[model samples]
Target: MFLQRVANRGIGLGTLLERAARRHPANILVFDHDLDAAPQLGRRATVGEAADAVADLASRLWASGIRAGDRVVVYKSDGFDITLLAWSAARIGAVPVLLSPQLDGATVETLMRRTGRPHLVTDGAKLQQELSEEVFDASQSVLLVTGSHPRARTLGSFAGVERVAPLEMPPDHPTLITHTSGTTGVPKLAVHTGRTLQARFRPQAAVTAPLRGRQVVAIHVSFVHSRLVTALAISLLRGYPVVILADGGTAHVADLFAGLKPTVLEAHPNSYLQWEELADDPRRPLSGVRLYSSTFDAIHPRTVQRLLAASERPAPVFGQLYGQSEIGPSVVRSFSRRRRQDADGRCVGVPFPGMTDVRVVSRNGRPPSAENPGYIEVKSDGRIVTYLGEDERYREQVTDGWWRMGDVGYRTKWGCVHLLDREVDLIDGFGSTLAVEDRLFGRVPQLAEVVVVPGADGRAVPVVCTRGDVPLDRAAWEAAVAGLPPMAEPVQWKQADLPQTATTKIKRLELAKLLAVGAGQEA
Candidate 1:
């Protein structure tokens, strides 16, 4: 089978850095923020130094009684060390359950309870500010990455602890656990094995195979995401020097990219949206970038057009991978500098032949089309084994080995998938809310974000955030929405006020609730 042919065995996350060091010990890693676990090591380190830090941290975790087959939950403040801590936990054969820093205290407690009293690894700010004191009570034992806690011992306290050999587990053993985007409700824990993760890496790595040796690959994925693990691994193992961003602020990114001039860039779609203004920067921060890559959601064509126009490289391309946390990237679509600005943003792209398959099932007993969309189902070796502690819930998504993506879309005659709206977010008679949003983005240059959600009255409502919170030009909006599906007057809100996932995807359902009550949401 193609799956087994691509990667017959699992890739080890624990010794990833160590393995990379063997081939490229001097490969440099630049960081914007200092690592909390190894502050003395500073913000920069070589592959060799990074490997040593992971090994050192693993010893500390072992000395603290984290053994093979155990689960360790890392819920510290935002830092690259969150990923390094995951590596360290895996080094000792303990499964790493990563929680996003964006998750609220109540949500964390719910996840901790779901993990069934797993050992918690966190920091001072979370303990004092965000998390409840009961977190300690819900954990098997709490370990601190930073700050003091009487109930927890600092990870650094075990600095001089004896080091142990890295334990290797079978390919099917649960390697990592990451949560979903939590757009609707509490996020579910997605359990991943080494084999499944490596399957995901294979397709993504193939995307970068065309690049030449030693391109400066800068990554800005969330620290706790499973994609970060494979993104780092692919770069490190391939000997590409890396630049990791802890902050996605425009000024910080401009200053850094002006100096380093990365060749390849990877970030979430919304992050790219946030950096659209960087195109006009005098320094041409994206000048040297050859490829712009994003995964997990559909990107706006307007955002793609602006970014590609900013790139000075010959034949720059924007690659979008449309999939979910439960299933790794199922389809890919790439946009080039020459592509028209009105390119169909809904056509997410085609599946990888032999490796991944996609099918849209009919909903109304008719062939699915733009008028009547259907459920998007996909099959891939990269699919997560199950939702941790929610086996039945996971089973509900799988039917005869195919995973339902919980998205409604139709396939084009050329085989491209047109993602319309999420299953739960669909509005009756409002043909494709996403297509409407895409058209709005293309029509309104001043708009930063526009989400179409159903109001309590079942009318489509557009929630808009202007670029700089500037007052929306009412005339421009009126002209933009002309001849389109009818919607309530645009509700203007500050971008920060919008409920977003860790990946920066706006929560449309949550936004709808806020607008349903007519709480003066208009700007």
Candidate 2:
């Protein structure tokens, strides 16, 4: 709450974190996951300890020639250390660009180049491998290795370096840069000023304030994502114990939750889908969960039903936020056990009354109406300043103050938002692909995940993953799809086989390309 108040005063994002550490020094800030060991838990840091770590790391970065206004690109495996480094860069008034480890080497190179040859911070071994693979450019950039290497200075080697004072900047000064999930094409870096980033956290604190210090908040979203940073800030400021999980595998999640029994859980929608079986686990790992939060994409109705049913806590609720990387949470809706069945899979509810404004506009510029679904646009305080190196592209999406969301949806008569599909992914014959997928989910009880993409012939193609290894029942599948546009034979994929963005949304464009190449020939 103090952080929220400070954010309202337009404080810098880096300074706000420092204030949180001072306010709640001894509170447990994070439970980081150990990626090297499958079952072992990673390290934990208190607010004071985390703050000190970040300050020390910031000194080290300064010693390594990073100065105010410089850009430092962080490309490392998931862990709390990445977070510390990012904050450290911000503290020194440098912009930190975080790249997901899930990104391919070529994409990484493209992002690094786009950042104007920013300094690279990554594992030494990984850097070498990338260089050998011809994906890294060492000629124009400086490298700051996180691990041992003869060619680069390691993070540990900079211990006890001289500390530098945080540079004072206006609230609107750029402090962090993160890329879009790039589901459609090359990822564009979304630039966030302290003002924009702080605006995001203020709303979160307001929503969760009542449960402050009473909940053990567990997060399993992408480490490089903006959500992680905001969540960490909220937990530290509110004195809630925080747990961070690096992997979203069902077994890993079960193992982690079995011991923690977190009261609040937040993750990507697909991560929740992967862990849906945990709802029925004998240990009842999710039984203590009081709140479940999902963002970035729409979640399935059946998944929400099962998860809420799994929780034994009285008045348990599932909070869904529909948003994008460029803008923070635009719309939010909550589901309780009583209302779970009433939720439409595509209805993302209404925009936050004062924080966001949403409009559905037709291609020819007609006003939005319930009868006519069109492109969705949003004007929000949390919108990013600009896409790094893509100013013109970013400008193209904005008209007046509203940003084109590239989504096809309409507002309901009740003032709720019903999302149909991404503009690029809309298939003509089947109407809304998401609506059809939701119908299939209701009929096919064993379905785990389903994505409808356009086929080479321009018809809807349903690509799905069934729960566990149980084979699909052909008769049931056929019956479920009876009236839909004639589909390409349903392609069955392992959940992990589907290409995904950092936030766990299937990369529809890439997945469609794989299907075109006959990746799922058996279907």
Candidate 3:
């Protein structure tokens, strides 16, 4: 069945789910957080059940006047229902724009305005709060609330609606819209078509084909992101029973893993950093994990080392994919116990031979060499067509066929991609913040995370978090940074206080702002 589907010209995003349901009727589709629990637990559903739910919801959306080519905005807290509803909208040929609930009301409002006031699907509680705060404009949108509200129509009202047949869309029809993490500025909505999504998932499916139906897969990432959709496709197509984790707190993940004992685990890098302590936990939550996958950003070597060691599986592997929201996964690398200790976190491996073309072009237009690092550019078939409502901005980043990655890095003599820093976050005196942070990892065993950001004087400053308030060893720190740039006295911050995107990447701009304020108080 899978072989036949792959031969099709293009598969619609909604069709993918429907096919999965037909192929694996009793296969589990979702494990959502239980609302009534003190320590939240998950509730399970089979693929057929989930497909029915999507059809029911799609009918309600169509009854609400949404039609082909119409836009529907889904703004809700993290939950399986958010993903289900997004796919439901797609099933009816309505483009679904998924916004993270973690985004502030102002950001949400800004995104809504840019999308031209589409129909909004949100919970009554969130709608009321945003409305009361004057951040959301009620007059511009028709509200579809999950819970009862005076000003909105409840989703429950359409619960009894008959299931509607899935709509057929052209391969290039826009099906999903999601925003960037907003690390630099207001997030831009990235538009994706079914063809683009299929392009992205094809490579992933090929690589993991060997593990199909044999591994229990567990995922803890933002449901609203593009990666989640790809993940769902991979799990469903491969017949892997999935455990979706909405709450990524260490305790919740630990509890879930203890019960499920997944053999394959995928999450944001920072999430793995937070779970390093589980390596030592008596429960041994990660013991059964054979594969650990991280995307979005480069992960620290120490974090990777610890996780690989935690897995009792003899040959545990860590897979890292370095790419952006605009383009799908570009470069890929795998780490095993043999290479764990000597792994350079900055080296993100080479681009897939046929999947992408990568180049490092210097500021002066010279070809990149090891010594002369420059901005990284990539040309991939899976790249997004354009940013919704920002064609000019999108075009600015694309020159000819290559897309500027907004990153500064150089390719090694062996063709590996070594990331230095985000173009905006590069500290003038410091070579690479990621490289510096990697060096600091082993120097202080208790240091959980260390970030180098520009200070008020424009010099590099290190902000660190130690495990359980372990005092920093001044002598060790001085020795570790011996030949490196002179850094400002390290500022201590609680791990939870560091601002991060939904993908678990530290907001370097925000961190710099925080440090500058601290410098002022000291003065």
Among these predictions, the greatest lDDT belongs to 1
Ordered list by TM-score, greatest first? 1, 3, 2
Which regions of candidate 2 are displaced past 4 Å?
1-11, 15-17, 30-32, 35-42, 132-141, 340-342, 364-372
Per-candidate TM equals 0.98, 0.93, 0.93
How does each model score on lDDT? 0.90, 0.78, 0.79
Candidate 1 Cα outliers beyond 4 Å, as residue runs: 1-4
Candidate 3: stretches off by over 4 Å: 1-8, 30-32, 35-42, 131-141, 340-342, 365-367, 469-475, 519-523
42-113 per-residue lDDT for model 1 (tens digits): 878998998888999999999998899999999989999999999999999999999999998899999999
- How far is each candidate from the true structure, as Cα RMSD in Å? 1.2, 3.3, 3.5
**Tens digit of per-residue lDDT, candidate 2, span 14-108:** 55567877787666755645432111223776666666767777888888888889888888766666777788888889888999887877788
Residue 221, candidate 3: C-alpha displacement in angstroms: 1.2
| Error at 253, model 2, angstroms | 1.1
Model 3 per-residue lDDT tens digits across residues 292-385: 9876888888888889999999898899989899998888888888775546788998877666778888976776654456999988767888
Which candidate do you rate higher for lDDT, 1 or 2? 1
